[model samples]
Target: MSDVDSELMAGLARMLAAGQQRRAARAQTALETLRSYERRILREAAVMGYVLGYQSGNLDGRTGIGGPLDKNNRIPPDSEILRRVIEHCDSTDDLYPFLAAACDRRRRSITKARRWPGEAGAR
Candidate 1:
């Protein structure tokens, strides 16, 4: 090919490669954002579970029963399984699994509630 054509082709190749890199970077950023959102949601859900559990226990005539917590940074919950789940984690990596456990209970509670809308202990 002519020198001009060769250079043009090379320039196009560079542009294509750069575009691909940009797309990959954008995808990575999107994935990271989604992951962050999921983690935050899980942590928040777990915290809600903890608060609800505490309230429920109080209402049900149980007094002074809850797991330890990290006050500075908000984390997820307490209970039969939730008590240990609340006391389980300290860091982000550790917290996710604990949060998941709490969320699992939340999930079960949801399913049970849906199945038996007017009953207690539906599951």
Candidate 2:
């Protein structure tokens, strides 16, 4: 090939490599964000579960009354809930709205229970 053509091909190759690297970096960032959201959602779900269980007297001093607990009698991670959420969601765009709404609802419920302890038993 001519020197000009060789140089042009080399430049194109470098551009392509740089573009791929940028794409990879963006993908890594997106993945990290998704994982962070998942962790936050799981943590919120766990806290909500604990609060509900405590109010309902399940965790007051009882064992084996209500649960999908492990042998150690601990509430397991909410992988099933996360899996179902992921299955129902078409994309991360959809996932965030749904998860955010769920977390908001749980937060409100916890707040209400705290403000009116008597009303908690009515639920």
Candidate 3:
């Protein structure tokens, strides 16, 4: 895995460990704190991919394989971004929690995309 992926995973493991020790209101605060790191990491990872690809001359005009990104590669999928999207999710109570969990799952998916083989052992 790349150094960026390792760093992000390390940050997430620490956040999760910290969350385990939190209680009551503190747990909510901790989760929000984690959410911020989650956003930062996702942004960094996406930027890393886009920058690497652009520098490698892989992206061309408006309609090639990956296509032209203009000023930005597609924005990374962020947990908070998903949470905002979930604000419009079906309001059926059970579905609300499921959507929230889906946001977390997306964050995890980004790491999995990195294919960090040692992440489980390291974390």
| Ordered list by lDDT, greatest first | 2, 1, 3
lDDT per residue for candidate 1 within 8-40, as digits (tens), equals 999999999996665444333323433466545
Residue pairs in clash, model 2:
none
Candidate 3: TM-score? Answer: 0.26
Q: Give the TM-scores of the predictions, in the order they appear.
A: 0.30, 0.31, 0.26
Scored by Cα lDDT, where does model 2 land?
0.49
lDDT of each: 0.47, 0.49, 0.46
The alpha-carbon deviation from the true structure for residue 105 of candidate 3, after best TM-score superposition, in angstroms, is: 6.2
lDDT, candidate 2, 26-52, per-residue tens: 433333445465557655765576657
Question: Among all windows of ten consecutive residues in candidate 2, which has the lowest summed lDDT?
Answer: 100-109
Residue 16 lDDT (model 3) = 84
What's the true lDDT of residue 26 in model 1?
39
Top candidate, metric lDDT: 2
